[model samples]
Target chain A: MNALIIEKTEDSPGVKFDPATAQLSLSGESRPENAGKFYNPLLEWITQFESILFWRKEQKMDQKPLVFAFRLDYFNSTSAKYIMDIILTLNKLADKGYPIRVEWYYDERDEDMLDAGKEFAEMVQIKFDFLPN
Target chain B: MRHFNNPVIKIGAHETGKPYFSHTKHQHLHFSQNIMQDNNSLNAYEVHKFMSKMDILVAFTGHFDHQMITILLKNIRGKLKTTSPEMAIEQKVYCILVECVENVSKYSSGNEDSSRNGMFMLCKSDTKYTVITGNPMLNKDIPSLKAKLENVSKMSREELKQLYRQQIMSERETENNAGLGIIDIALKSGNQFHYNFKPLTETTSFYHFQTEIEINS
Candidate 1:
């Protein structure tokens, strides 16, 4: 699968989802003027990844533990909804026998960010490894 | 220096063209007139002093857009980082500021075109920080807005979080009005907020929204 790499902007986050390495990450602030325009494509990519995972299963290819890292410093409410969508999508992927792990990195001083991660974790019923940066 | 024939002293303009005034019957017209004469040129020092007295750390009035909001957030981030003792409080304040200003840009009546007129101010007291925002909104939207505000204000923290999650997941939520932003604000500030809608006309009203966060320092 091709990697999805998007450079961060003043109001959007940097995204790098490498299928070969099985490491996906989003970092920086997210307060895009149009949250859907920025996030919908990423959600579609994840959905495509799910289809690829199914094809790999038919070929009996060993699945790697995919890690999705979220290192966001700040995100608006609208962006938060999209993040939740991303995680819930990942949760569905996990339910389909994909080995997925979510790593949530937040500033040690930003308890709100940490709490946001916790809320996502609880809402999706996923174990997120919270790391303070 | 255009004079009006009605003898009504124009203190300012409301909604751009409507004159708001002090009538000559109030007996303070002379003092107001004196200030108006001096107001031909604003005294920057006096304005600064007034802001300082009001404990206003930041204030802006006029048009707002995504680009302008980004610039304001950059400056606000720097200011909060320096003055706020804890990063948690700074992050909350910053988040709340973004919501307030973004709402201004998105929902202000003037935003029907490209012009988004609003007012924003961040003031600090000994124990809490207050954010104030005002914008003109269509009067027809007031009842629903008032109901939303009242409903959220009455909710508990946990209930607000639940509603936030539900709203985010609901398919009915739209790009422009998910109604999650206010829920987020209420959750962050613990519902320590107030809102008012003052009728500007039969078709429009000026909305004032203020939220407060206690300084945990």
Candidate 2:
């Protein structure tokens, strides 16, 4: 699968999904005016990756465990909806017997961010590894 | 107490021999001379004192645009860093302020010039920091907006979480419960927010919204 990478902006988070490393990461702030424009591609990329995973499984290729790290300092509510979508999509991958791990990183001082991650994890019924920075 | 030496309105003759309002670093005023001379004229020094008394850290009233919101957020972030440097409180305050200002910039009806005009303020009391925003909107939106606010205001944290999830999962992104912003604000402020609608004209109303984040010392 081709990697998807986007640089971080003042109002958007950096996105990196590397098939080589089997890791997907989002970092920095996310408060874009049109969040769908920024996140829709990411969701599409994830769906594409799912297709690749299924193909690999069918071909009996090595299935690497995927890791998705979320290191968001801030994201507006509009972005939050997309974030939930991203998580739900990932959870679907997990449901399909694919090994998936979610790492939620937050500043130790930002309890609200931690709480938000917790809330998302609960909503998706996923046990996320909460890492405090 | 900090003293404001500069006057908000400096009354003086312009170089062209016409009386005009002079602005200082404290404030910019374009009121008529008669208004400036009124007993209720705003004095920057007095306003500064009043702000100090009310624990107001930041206030703005003007056209809200994307650039303006970015600048305001940067300024407020700096001010909060200096005035109330607690990380968690700062994040909550910043998040709520972003929502409030962005809400105004996005949803508020255009004024005479079709610009997004609104007012925003941040005040810190002994126990909490308050974010207030006011903007002009169509009167038709009041009933639905009021109901949303009332419903969200009455929800507990758990209920808010559920609503947030439902809104995100809803098929219609732009319809009812599109109040993801309000729910987010309520959740961030620990479920403490107030809102009001003031009738401005037959077709429009002034919307006032306030959110508070507790200062845990």
Which numbered prediction scores highest in DockQ against the true structure? Answer: 1
Give the number of colliding residue pairs in candidate 1: 0
How high is the lDDT of residue B18 in model 1?
Answer: 33
Docking class of 1: medium
After superposition, candidate 1 runs with Cα above 4 Å error: B1-41, B110-115
Per residue, candidate 2 scores C-alpha lDDT tens digits across A1-133 of 6899999977889999998778999999888767778888999998889887887789998988889999998988888888888999999999998888899999998998998898888877556999987
iRMSD per prediction, in order: 1.1, 2.7
Error of 1 at B5 (Å): 42
**Weakest ten-residue segment in model 2 chain A by summed lDDT:** A118-127
The per-residue C-alpha lDDT of model 1 at residue A61 equals 92
Q: What is the DockQ of each candidate?
A: 0.73, 0.58
Cα RMSD over interface residues, candidate 2: 2.7
Give one digit per residue, the lDDT tens place, for model 1 in B1-217: 3122223221335453433334344454333223222536445565555456446799888788778888888899999999988889889999999998988876688335534788898887767788888888877767877888899999999899898878877774568664788998998898988777767667877788888888874
Cα RMSD (Å) per model?
Answer: 6.6, 7.0
